[model samples]
Target: MIEVPSRVSVRDLAKVFQDGEARVEAFAQITLEARPGEFLCLVGPSGCGKTTLLRCLAGIETPSAGAIEHRLEPGAPGAEQAMVFQQHGLFPWLTVEANLHFVLRESPVPRQEHDAIVQRLLERVGLARFRRFYPYQLSGGMNQRVALVRAFCVQPQVLLMDEPFVFLDYQNRIVLQDLLLELWQEQRQTILFVTHNINEAIALGDRVLVMPGTAGPFAREISCPFGRPRDVVQLRTNPDYQRIVVEVTQLLRQEQEHSLREGRIG
Candidate 1:
């Protein structure tokens, strides 16, 4: 039988980057927790350290201060976390199947299990027919789908996504959003998604954290109690969804104004 894993705790996290003579504080004292099977969305302006924070969580970048602790089960997969970035990050030379298999090959599982995992993920992402196609042969949205499949094939415990759907057109975004939701439900992975789109955040997240301005940490956290299997059409018509969107937009506007004033003062 399979056992459950613990949650992720991020406490007093801070990151600073030096650009020549200037010291830029990207984030400071960010405290948040992501429970198992939770969908958390981080929304902010263009340079509000959303991606920086994601990098910290992924262990790709060490924080300047504080801690990001992953409480996983003993002998588990070392806090399996996979990231899907704005760029598809696919191998142009390799076919879709090869790209997915590349990620699976790094796992400790036996070689015989690789084929099953790759095949299942390809079918789940609607890429079975295009498995032999290279990155250049697919559309932008389809390439992003391949990236998604690659990320999921590892069976990560925590999934980190940074603007994964920003490049797609409105129609494709909606379709992919639905497909992503279905995949998330099936996998039950703890997901932390960063996006600039307010509507997209509300549509995909169980909780939304808003970060304002180009500096510092998140300004506010909003809990979305909306039920699962959310229909985009129904949510657009829902009063609660509209209210939260308006509120988040207002908060973002306030942050922008604050940043402008500070810039002018300096």
Candidate 2:
């Protein structure tokens, strides 16, 4: 049986990078939590430490201060996490099927089931036909499809995504957004997605956390009023969606002004 989703908690989180008396504080004095199966989106201007925070949650980077906890449902199996980056970090030498297998080498999934897991997820994403194809042989959008399936194949407890579709054309972005939501609806993993697109954040998230312009505590936490399963294309027509867009935009505008006053951004 699949382990239930985990709840994430962070207390007084901070990250600082130092090099020979040169000190850079990525973010500091932060506190947040993600409820089980909740889709959380992080939004901010560039260099607000969004990615740094995500790395901490994924256990890739250690925080300079504070605590992070991934508390799974009682009696559930152990937790697993996966990440999808803006770049499709697939090996040119490996075909799509092989790339998925490579990730499972370090994953908890059984070796005997690896082939089936890869095949099922690829088929779910309509990428089964391209399984033997190399990443270089695929379009940027198709490679991203492979990347999405690869991340989901492990059925991670926490899925960290960093602007995975930012570079795609509008049409493909929308299509992939639908695909991602469809997969998440079934997989129900706790997601922490980082994106600059306000619409994307609101459309995909249950709650959106807006960060300050510079490295500091988070700015605002606004709950998305939309009900799921959401349709991204039709979401714009909803009055509340438009209202939330304006609301988040206003909050971001305020954050930019604050950054300007603090000399954090020019």
Candidate 3:
């Protein structure tokens, strides 16, 4: 696979939807950047356009305004930018192993190397024994992990994930979070992960970008003071972790309160 620059820049970005005669602004003037191999997490209230923003970054949705620039090498798709939605998006008919292989179909990974790649990923997720299980046969967390494996198999330079584990139960979610950090440490891809869970955001991101509830710029940018090689279970017990959570929760509340005063949101 070809290596490409992982830096992503979004400038004066905005997304608006036309609801008949009404123009609904999904978000506006959103500017941010994620450096190479950086894990940037986005947190926002419902309808704040976090998912929409990710879709735009993935080239799945066109923005209503502004520009998103990726400094990829010319003639390369930047290790082929990959996006994972909240939905597993896996083929139900395909077994877990088959699903991972499916994504490699268009990837630069040689067909002969596909099996080894899949083997490594499945083992990493501790799902090697269940490789033949279909999506319907696996739990939500397992299926989501498979989805993660699928994305990583492509060896994307930039990974945009929208609430990939939001639907899972707590235990599964933490395990996956740790697994994700491990995978990311190995691949060092530029990751932009969206989550409503602030603790999850704080646990995983290098910096947390809050989209907020109002019609203005982002609420705030909070840096995670924790060092890398983070353990989800251990992170929660730290005093700094509690402080950061309070700080983020307050910011989101401030945004929502401001929106309420302005009558922008309920």
Candidate 4:
């Protein structure tokens, strides 16, 4: 597969929503840069505007203020970006294989190669046998995996993920995380992932950015010391991993406390 390189630059970003007669600030004065093929994770408590910022970056939502610039290499595919939601967002009527085909149908992949692409991705994730199964027939974890590869099959230049594993049980979440990492390592799409899980952030991110719940820029930034081709399961045993976790935990706690004191969170 050919690589489509892209860079994302967000400057002084701010978002506000209307609630009856009042305006609520989801995030503000946020500035950041995502280099090509970089895995950047946004971790923060609820209402931190993590998802809001992601939507803005995806061009799904219009920011009240600020600018986002996307530089796509010439000849990049039209569908240069894709998003994975917290919910599976699978079609209840479509079978697993059919669901994948739905995405490929709109992608730049040629018609003759669609079947091959679908088969290869399904086999890589061990879902080849479940091709005929409907979404309801699969477990929550399997559905999430389907959502993931569906995005990957599109061969997007930028992938935006909003806590795709948040609803799964511990074991399933870890399993999907490993699968995600495997695909990401191979494809290396510029990704903006949102998660409240600190461990998951440290496990997957090349750099972790912490947001302060209200309209504010990232409160902290931590670069991962662990090397890539990471073993998410074994990361817990590494002393450096533990130390970074502690540091991030403290940063989050401070933000949580500030939000509480300001009555932003109950």
Candidate 5:
């Protein structure tokens, strides 16, 4: 079996904004990598630049300093990376098939294969019969499923997701999480996911990074060694899973306190 190339690398990454005379550091000295075909979850407090870091990885924002490198495997099928946003960015007017086709049209795949690829993904997600339905016609979870499939439809080498299911209730969130895992298990694309929920992070990530706050980059990297095809509901009750979640949550709390103290001193 051939090894997949490392999909992304960030070195001494920093993003700063100028607010009048004051400098705002979103995040700095953030060094990390998205291992080939692995899921990496990022967790942090609000204003800690999780989304900013993700946007930088997506090439949607220029870093004020440092570098982000993306290496594609030889003969890779599509773009180097694709991002799924928190808002479930499906076009309101486009049908499900049309939404997926919109992405494929931008990929390197042959135009004639677009329809077949779109149909296959929709079928896999159990949305085959809703191909002609618009975004407004579907429930929030269904729309999110479409957004996810659309991202995968591009067959990207890396997937960057920023809390794509954060707004959904527990049932919907877990369902989409399972759907995401299923798609990922089949394709094994490199993924960098950002979330506030520690349980969600542990449930889906191979490694979870905890960001301290705006004052620091990533403060800790916790490894989750659970076996494949994880059942979130069952994992919730598993002692090992609970232990990891508590460890991660404690780190987050400590970071928040540290940040508050530093703020007062500054």
Candidate 6:
């Protein structure tokens, strides 16, 4: 198989925040590449700047230093990137279908084409029956599914997710993960996901990037060589999957210890 170049590249990325009279360094010299059609997860302790990194990639926030270059397809209008947050950023006043249609309408597509796209996405996310239902009528997981479909409908080249499944219950999270994988396979969009959950990251990511702490330049990168169309049930019994999870868990533990040591010193 021939190797393709990275779709997105970040070199020497750094970010700083002003806290009172002092300058607080969040991360420095962070370098990473997101290859085409790869699911990359950024995992670390809370406040480890994972969300900030995701924001930078989404163009929601600018990096204090370094460069991020998105190599878009020829003739494409800018680089299409979308972000899904932990909160379901849905409009309460709009119905499920209406919420999706609202986003689609913003695009340059004709009204007829936009309607078709919104209908298909609603059905795809298993919200066809809830199309007329408002956000308050849907459960937390269902609302999140709407959010995911809303983002996917735009056909973004890159999807930036920050703990999108964090609010769901265990069973809901599992179901949503499977649905997300299905959508990802169907769309083949490059994804950069941030999560504190190790198992979730291991299950979803083709490569996991682990950041050490809030002020981290990511410390480690682990590749998941397991074949996909990955099944949650089968993964529990797969030795390779188990081994990688163990390795990642160990790495996280080490980071925790390092964080504690730093805390004591400070």
Top candidate on lDDT is 4
Candidate 6's TM-score: 0.93
> On residues 1-266, what C-alpha lDDT tens digit does candidate 5 reach at each position?
98655678898999898889987788889999877889999998777788889999888899999998988787877767789988889888899998888878888877988888888899988999999999999998999999999998888889999999987889999989999999999889899999989999999999999987545568999999898989877888888899999999888888777766666222
lDDT string for model 6 (22-141, tens) is: 776667788999998899998876555777888888888889999999876665432377789999999999999889888777754457777777788778878899999999999999
Clashes of each: 0, 0, 0, 1, 0, 1
> RMSD, each candidate, Å?
3.2, 3.1, 3.3, 3.0, 2.4, 2.3
TM accuracy, model 2: 0.93
Better of 1 and 4 by lDDT: 4
Model 6 gets an lDDT of 0.84
Give me the displacement of residue 49 in model 1, in angstroms: 0.5
lDDT of 1 by residue, 1-266 (tens): 87554477898888999889988787788888888989999987666688999999998899999988877645554227799999999989999999988777876555787798888878887789998999999999999988988887777888999999999999888888888888888887889999888999998899999875746566899988789888865798888999999999999888767667756211
Q: Candidate 1 or 5, higher lDDT?
A: 5
Q: Lowest lDDT 10-mer window, candidate 3?
A: 71-80
lDDT of 2 by residue, 1-266 (tens): 98643488898999998999988787888898887889999998677688889999888999999999988655443237889999999999999999998888877667888888888888888889999999989999999999998888877888999999998999999989999999999989899999989999999999999998766678889999788899998999999999999999999988878767766543
Ten-residue region with minimum lDDT total, candidate 4? 71-80
Candidate 5 Cα misplacement greater than 4 A, ranges: 1-5, 262-266
User: TM-score for every candidate vs. truth?
Assistant: 0.92, 0.93, 0.93, 0.95, 0.94, 0.93
lDDT at position 137, candidate 5:
95
Instruction: Decide which is better by TM-score, 2 or 5.
Output: 5
Candidate 2, residue 151: how far the Cα is off, in Å: 0.7
Model 3 per-residue lDDT tens digits across residues 70-168: 876455432557888898999998999988887898777678888998999999999999999999999899899999999988888889999999899
The lDDT for every candidate, in the order shown, is 0.84, 0.88, 0.87, 0.89, 0.87, 0.84
* Shift of residue 68 alpha carbon in model 3, Å: 0.3
